[model samples]
Target: MLGAIYLSQEINPHNVMVNQETKVEQEGQHFFLRSKKDFDLYPTEIRIQLGGCEYFILLNGRIDDREHLFQKLSLDANKSVSDTYLIGMLYQKFDLEFVNFLDGDFAFSIWDKQKNRLILAKDPIGIKNLFYSVDSGSVIWSSAIRNILHIVPNQKVNSAYIKSFLLDHPIANESTAYENIYRLESGEFLVCENGHIKKDYYYQFKIPSITYRKEEDYFQHFNQLFERSVHNRLRTPDNRVSIPLSGGVDSSSIIAMAENINKKDNWKYNIATYSIVFDEKEADERKYIKSMLEKYNLKSTVVYGDEDWNFKIDFNVLKELDEPYPLFNRALASKTLSAAKRDNISVVLTGHGGDHILHADLNYLGELLKKGKIINYIKDLKQWKNKYPLHQILKQNTLDPIFRKTRLEYPSWLKKERFADMDLSTILTKRFEELKWDSKTITAYFNTIIRQTGHEWFDQYLSNPIGVERRYPFLDVKLMEFLAAVPPTLKIRPANNKYIIRESLKAYLPIEIYGRTTKGNHSFLITKGFKEEWNRITEYYDFKILTELGFVNGEEIKEYCERWYMGYRYDLYNASGIMRALALEIWLSDKQDII
Candidate 1:
């Protein structure tokens, strides 16, 4: 991806602006650029000089194959294109709002000489990352944090908010692990000129409550949007596709739809389904997986994930992730990505993000209470008792919402005495502090959908090296917009969650697949991976990174590690904190010459 900078007068004239690739600018320091070496012919860097003024633009992703925006810019259809045409259109189009008019996964920057401004933007969903640090009067931006680290070599790790990272997963704000370094929020366009910076949000996604009396209308509209989302992702080289299947409703739904589309289409690559399996029946989900395979006559690849656990940090993995992340599913993702690469697959369609958007939440019952629809609430409560008892119904549907305890906290492990003694946040950004308990209806669930994801950073971050683009239909803009407008009752009806999906897709999906209520369990599989790799993980575990920051309880953690593998010690060895600690070891110890 693209990494760039607009140099200011405050820079050490002969110093920070000079690099292996940087040339001494005769006048005020100009643009500096770098691109990852592996993203095919995508623009590494592009520089254009007009009227004695030099300009540069670098793009780190593919333009959409569906939209011919480049054609309007007088360019060829491409997997990768330099930002020349886009930069030209900025001045020609004369509108700073041109970004939202296009679609693709990219993080790009434009250095305009005449205007003397550096503009940086990320794609709509935040799939691509752009981070910046404005110091010494210069605004430095890049696709990766490591590149910006070049300017501030001794950037202190922001241990103050490590609690936020461990709990919410993504920081969900401008802050990064390093001091003064901030990530560009998704769809934000930043313009920095003459020591001043201004930001504009290019997209807004909000949940609005709307309902239709005709149920078929909702189903038909959803199907059209769903198909288009899948179709847009298939815009790849040779239509190579792979699905990571769990036989759950979401993945199975994608498979069912894709199989139907494939059967009726012209010459297209046959889709492959990859299933992570185990020798133990509790862990293996082949029985649930088999119904779809038998129905569709599809090709399948089964691999044991936990059998050979790869918990030790690989050098390549260390190099890929910019920060320490506790994505425990890295082993499964990396292994599957390697397989996709071997099979020449260019895009892997996933069913992540479906749970949050598709499945309705019990929190919606709060809406019924607020609206004073007591009779409907009682009827739904009767159906709720089919699964949960009255006490749980009261606690989750009423008491919790009334008390406004809707916010998810750091797991029990993070609350241990070791962590309590250390300084945590008394002052938190609004997001970290509390939730809007009054809006705990479907809104709470929508917020939850965005917080965490099975489509983890490892899956997206490792894609460049492995040459696979993992696309989630569930996160599609059109699909989400449709879901946002759907009434919560349509999402959850009686005892069924994702009521619309189950009811709408029953004809296409296998009977067993559509009717299945409980999802497959992976708790044993995950614990097994940790148990097998405990020694090797703890042996190389250096406590210096934590000690240097004074943020970790080294003695407490060491004690927990000694006993964690023996049994379930939730607070002592919380899975979240342990995995994060292991990942942090690699991030803190790295001495790579990145800058």
Candidate 2:
């Protein structure tokens, strides 16, 4: 939503021409700023002069705590607080550490003329995106990668990124698909001073060691933090917001919390619900969705997901995506956004980060065993046996990590020669090293801060074409920290995942909605789409871009796809690979068109 260029001393700042999308522009001695209209209610960018230091800020999302910050910083509370103005005041007061006080889905850049310093930072949870490329001492940054690519065409592809994408893992650093272009990671910042660029974390994930002895205390804390997150994100024009209600606990819990807040505080807001229905029984959650609607007496815009899937590419949306993505249920996601757009809704709240933050798996069982808690481990094991077969639980939680040297299952179609040096498996290993699996706190941290960062950016950018900003209440930093600090037992019990969420919202949610254990499996939609468009998929493979790029074995991939198509048995892994291969080819073809 915003882009800026800090030119080197040699290049004339006046020669820089920003993109046409820039609604607001500011040029300083060494920097030229351009930002799009993000929120109609707030200015896109703010410029202020304080203590002989010229300051400019471009923000993509609102700072949720700006009002509190105004009082803390002793600013004029009567004056309206815009996102940019509040951040400017914070910087003038707190200096560089101003980033730590921010809480929201935002990506922003701060320019200080007095110090000749330019600082670029992303939010702690990375719900918003910030990408930059440093060339010959000048730096270019933007919320959208396409803007940076438009300025400096990045033709050279990064093989590491390709490997990560194919394997469905993050690149483990700031490297993007294009060489020399970098994405700022969550809680990270880049500082340009004295013609030198230094990168460090403005926020670090410190798992709090404090634990409340009572379960009620944890429940009370969660309700407060989560309600605050939802309330903060609901700050839109006229208090109107849209939600993607899937009938699952994550999305359902958000609505329940919001409704509770509305009734408790005597506040009013409009919530439009959008849902994707399926003809296939395996993929349908209509029964549960119906329960949610009946319980709340709310109507929803229904999207027929089965009718929506096809192997067609929308170049307009595809080109906007900076990299190839094997998006889970693309049709469903697109339809949801389109529905929100049709309703004239600007903000769409999603329940994405719940599984990452709240649902800690049985891996914590392994941790309990490792920590010499034999008695506790036995009790936990007995509880897990009720849900899963005893053999399966032990193999997954205990045997797998100890015996397996590497967690990655290298695809046979991947060219070893092309990725011979990249240690992709070490991605998970490194995270485990930094934070051990001694508790579900560490497990939840791994699932969220480490693993879910890529998906956060992908979801945000996916809504770009539809012009709807997607917000995640579950990814709230305060709520995440609370869940991470709680005992693993509170997260995963004998037969339930996200035990705390299910238990905490008992008053707000109906038993049918909260007590449900299984989630709707939409993977069937992937294979169903692939089968429906089999001929077109084959034709796409004929393009041979992956083979030309030396990243895949063309014959092997074709054979694998043929086996999946002809075989009667369902193979989830093969289905996933075929989808990713097709996605990569489509992206490559789009790249060729651009070239």
Candidate 3:
């Protein structure tokens, strides 16, 4: 884990003092002390100025030293501390109030020595993680719980939170898997001064005023915005970039764009593409991935899974993750990341946010159609009706008018009811109860779904070659803002979901891939594989563990496992019930005094 620490003392401590004369004369004044782990990426440096002092600390990765840009931004060279250009610019340009100007997956702390204040911030998406604690006279922060626990005494697990974990698979935002340590939520900032801590939210996805426009105009704007996002992510040079290609539009589009950029710039760098191939026919998409790789002449690696690989779930590898995330395709991703780390790849690109924003699901399309803006409604209806049967179109349109009129008229109870069927109570902890049901909750749920899935996948990426960055071009803030502004009809049309996205990429992608109907091919394969191996997986973990923990009804779980062995989809749901139960059981085991 990467971590940074800052200490402000009345005088420079002997351990941190830089000058021998100051130590002998006892003239060490108020100074800043910074310590960082994995400092090969950042060397120790000190700068002093006429006005104040600044201490720079770096960890985890190579420092990008574009000095001209730093000067252009008016960074204080004499007393400046910055690990990344983005972080430096934020502090220099906006100081403690700079949270709104940044839009990257980063967490940083700025110690304004002159003002005797400390500023800490986290990314909008909570991608890069940071946690801190402020005591009466001291403040400490770390990238991992262990780091903080090492320095601070009397660290003990919170038993009540552990009890909650036993009941729910993961703890809520207010609680951590451990006690007394709190994670700064995504888009949050904390300022510490004189032992008082004030936390504030700095960023959130703002739904834009819908503009009714020509469909082509929206499509063009989306294409340009998406391309720019991809370009920004690819700006770092000489890094061996890997794309988690799934042969779907999201990952495939990223691969195609990277290839296009490589060709245009005459870049010699090889883009390493990785995809998982399972023994199960449905799970294996290697053939399609191979087709794309050959079509583009891109260098690729296919990680084929065997039976043994299916049973490999190392909870210890991802112990840092605060909760028990549903380990679906991420198991494969973890294996791939290990392989990539072995190959010395530092950054892996993924198409995580594409589905939530650009490639929205049919449900979002339905919401748009319900709005009944006559021209858009008719346009979408014609396109959808043509692709689907006449009766289906009529039925959908019939339902649309009701939702359109009642969309904003939803009572709190009805909004809860709308999401109840999705089993959010089971997925989200009681924190869902405190949250008001509104567009923010809806957006949070949506973003939570993406972040949970992405972070689970990213767990593997982080395990190897410590500090390997996993970049998501699709989650770019500008692209999301643009998508929020565009009319929903353009985002998801009747003929195909993400119709505009596909149309925009017509020239860049293969026709077969562009016109593909399967939204995600991984789930089917995962379910099929789980069914095939149900017996082994069930028996591997003692059924009594789940029963004794009071997380699941033991007899019911055993019966479901038996039914799953007999080949039934009804049993699959039962298996999911057991899976959730077992996950909670495992989560409880990690807590102090629970077992």
Task: Evaluate all candidate structures by whole-model CA lDDT and list the values in order.
Answer: 0.64, 0.72, 0.54
Model 1, which residues run further than 4 Å from truth?
9-27, 39-55, 62-91, 263-265, 268-270, 310-320, 407-448, 451-456, 459-461, 493-495, 540-564, 567-573, 589-595
Give me the candidate number with maximum lDDT.
2
Q: What value of lDDT does candidate 2 attain over all alpha carbons? A: 0.72
What is candidate 1's lDDT per residue for 1-595, written digit by digit as tens? 4344536556653455434354335357655665555543234446665446566667765545334566655655664544455554643455476676666666778777667677888766666667898776667777677777776677777754464564445543577777778888766789887767999888755655556679988888888778777766665656778887778889888888777677667637568888877667666678778888888877678777656443634534653466767655656666666777789886788887887677556666666776788998788888887877889878767556556643534444344443554333422323422332234333444444443453335444666657777777787765776787786667876556788887778888888877776766555645566577776666545466654554455666666666656655554426556667666655656633221
- Model 1 TM: 0.83
Residue 494, candidate 3: C-alpha displacement in angstroms = 3.6
Show pairs that collide, candidate 2: none
Better of 1 and 2 by lDDT: 2
Candidates in order, TM-scores: namely 0.83, 0.89, 0.76
Put down candidate 3 lDDT per residue, 56-163, tens digits, no spaces. Answer: 322222222335445645666665544454454545556676566565556666555555556667766665556665443456565555555655545565544444
* Sliding window of 10 residues with minimal summed lDDT for model 1: 427-436
Winning candidate number (TM-score): 2
Provide backbone clash counts, one per model: 0, 0, 0
